[model samples]
Target: MSSLPYLKKLNNAFTIFSRSYAFKSDLKIKWVRPEKIPCFKPEKSGDLQGFSNINKSETILEFQNSKELATADNNVKKLFSLEFAPKKCANNLYIKNMMSKVQRHELDFSTIETKIARWTGIIRALQESMERFPRNIRMKVTLKELIDRRKKHLKYLRRWDYKKFEWLLETLDLVYKPPPNHFHWITRKESLKKLTDKYCDGIKEERLKAYRLTLENEQPAFLEEKIRTLQFIRDEQKACNVVVTVTEEEINDVKNQLEELKKKNAESNNQLN
Candidate 1:
């Protein structure tokens, strides 16, 4: 006998069990309509079209960490001098100093530090180009690549020597913050804010919409409260009328009893006389 018969029986049992208990899983899946999704659509402009050729996002102008560096205004000579080149170092003098720092056996072009220094020079050139032609997408893309390449070089330095990484960051006047290893995708505090912002004109508009809906849904409750209050007032007035009637009838009966007592007193006086 083959094991196929046993396998078939197990499969049938699993199918029956799944059919009977599938609802217990409490899995709810909702299909969203495409129109309900919020998307950013850039305006169609000739200037924006020039950006289509660029795939990378460039960094905006930022403050350098060091006031002295900022005052120097990113002059190429100042940058090379700040990198520990000789005083009043010209471009060729700066390159000669960088070459002297390389090991005897190491290729000048192949060293990591040499590559990093060369990339910095390239980045400064790109930065100047971008400042002149801010809307040029090609220059922006090239600047982005240079910055990215610098970051990779920094990371390699950090992995080999953390102290050197910190020194480089200080010397470059760039901020460095390591990214977190784990990220939470499901829980977001700003989702509601973003959702409302995307769909509504403003917070005031959202509030007005919410208020209108609340008024529409509250009609039944308002009517019920009005009916209850009117009925309560009517009941109170009826109770006052009943109490006044009972009190007046008792007062009239007491007056009649007093008159009868006065008549009895007068007849007793006449009989005694």
Candidate 2:
């Protein structure tokens, strides 16, 4: 009976993955030249651990035919990290939606993975545009930068940290639940840290404000959770007494992400309003 539920889950996973990647191309079976994402067969499934391969010694920090090309290469890792992590949920949605728009507006890549990176960069350019707006007024500004001008290339987010990428992927879908309790008891904090590191780039100031507010009286919760996994706390009183901890910015960013997710039903297949 247990195997039956697991098999059903496997079948459902395939169905969900299929829907999510229905528009993906066959070219995805191979690694896009500079991409850090790994390839997995239908038999083995793709591995996220290979994501770190992009940082290999292949990087040439020398002069280039184009200074811009050199700059882009240097920026790829930072850009990937920022795009995947630093941005708030709104920022992430804006960037990803921007990517979808760019993909629709241009044609170059033959693979879904390649196109995802190129489009990901396209979205970053959009967020950068948003910076010019004043803080109080909420303005929606779309960049008219021609898609023909974007330098399309493969980029890796992190070495295929299957553990990390899986969570980030869930962020996109908006209906993520942790793995089983035992698997997650320790990993949740690591996963949360990865999220804040990767996706909480923009609005960092605002998010910090929120986290501090949540932690004001919640010391024991943080300590107990930390001990279960990190095993750092020796005493409940000691954990509570610690002065510095996760910032308000990190807390707010996390809450905002979760709130944005709750606003929609990703796994249930309801489209966002």
Candidate 3:
């Protein structure tokens, strides 16, 4: 009897978010989508026979703490690099120091740092790929990531007592609630969890593949960067190597928010019109 209400909530969340985020052709308003470029996930296998070889949804790994784990759209390296909260070592001062190195090397710090961070995160995801994908061939990689992240999270919480952690969890609900699901089948918590897990593996696999490609390409870029830095080379010509291959997800995110704002403005104007 107690579990029934929880299922009711999950069902509602699924319905609300799904309807709000369903696929469409040439959306009339971009703002309805996202202010932040969300993670991307390839469609399920066999959705399109033309691209049958693409089975990214079946293989990649995702750590336990990742926020985008439930989202339909998932970006590989970026998702792995995504952190819910920044710890002390990851504060603004530390970031500024890191950026100084990029400046000294005459490289755009944003691009350099993004790439290095992504590299680190993917390597981390690979390290923890097993716990994330217990059944996958490369499970050890995920396990390593999980262990490392636990240490990091625990390190971050070192100053806080057990009560603080519990309070943090409680505050989350006040600030965030799962979207409601209109789909009846996803009403149960256990049922929803199982369903998401099956698809999550596939998404993780795709992310892993993308990260691999990115890593393969990173070798030459990093070496070239090292060479130029050592030689004290600083020029726009070095920008090519400096460019990090972050997905252009931020653009759409901005557009989506813009659209939402415009929509509200238009509605207000209509009242005047």
Candidate 4:
């Protein structure tokens, strides 16, 4: 019978504890949410040609403005051209551009620069596909693997031939983001704690500013009241034929402080105006 009461008390305590520490769905703390990692793929990864490239203005054979069985009408040609071609074609163009100098021949796929360029092209295409179909887990995994592989190749190239590595990066317009020395998973508890501390600090700063303004506003009144009280005390002591504790020097000092404060406040107000 005594044990029943003890168990009931224990259950109640557990309920209270759980409620106290429970995550509040209603509270919208931005820090508690995971940060959206940006796609590291270069913006111009899939570009067919440079803006200033003379060839960019010329049409491909299949899309040339001519009447041929292989070539379609101008509208259809524009639609099916390299500019509007599928992702695969764009990736090929990007890879070709990157490997232009480093590649010995058309079959040179084993080189570090070529491999990086290939992976970079694929990553750019996959990222675009992922944006359209975000739920494709297989594609996401492939993209992540490709990115890691490219990073490894880049690291090797950087150590072996730094000049070539720099040239490759410039050609591809790629930014190499090295892995952190120590990987730290962002946990909700730690993030929320930091956010809470920031919030508290902001409130503390705001309150302090308000208090300071209040003190500044009351300074003149306070000094005036203090001067009156001291003068009255001195007068009363002299009238009663007693030694005055509050001296004339002290009153002069307070008056000087009040004048200085007024001058400072005026200068500040003038500056503000």
Query: Which prediction has the highest lDDT against the true structure?
Result: 4
Q: lDDT per model, in order?
A: 0.51, 0.41, 0.42, 0.73
What local lDDT score does residue 149 receive in model 1, on the 0 to 100 scale?
71
Task: Decide which is better by lDDT, 1 or 2.
Answer: 1
Clashing pairs in 4: none
- Residue 119 Cα positional deviation in candidate 3, in Å, after optimal superposition: 62
Sorted by lDDT, highest first, which candidate order results?
A: 4, 1, 3, 2
Ranked by lDDT, the better of candidates 1 and 3 is 1
Winning candidate number (TM-score): 4
- Model 3, runs deviating above 4 Å: 1-192, 233-273
User: lDDT by residue for model 1 over 57-169, one digit each (tens)?
Assistant: 21111222446544554454344342444322333333333444442454567767666655654555445445567788877777666666766777788899888677655
Task: Name the regions of candidate 2 deviating beyond 4 angstroms.
Answer: 1-63, 66-108, 134-273
Q: Model 1 — TM-score against the truth? A: 0.30
Worst 10 residues of 1 by lDDT: 38-47
- State the lDDT at 4 in candidate 4: 100
- Mark the 10 consecutive residues where model 3 has the least summed lDDT: 40-49
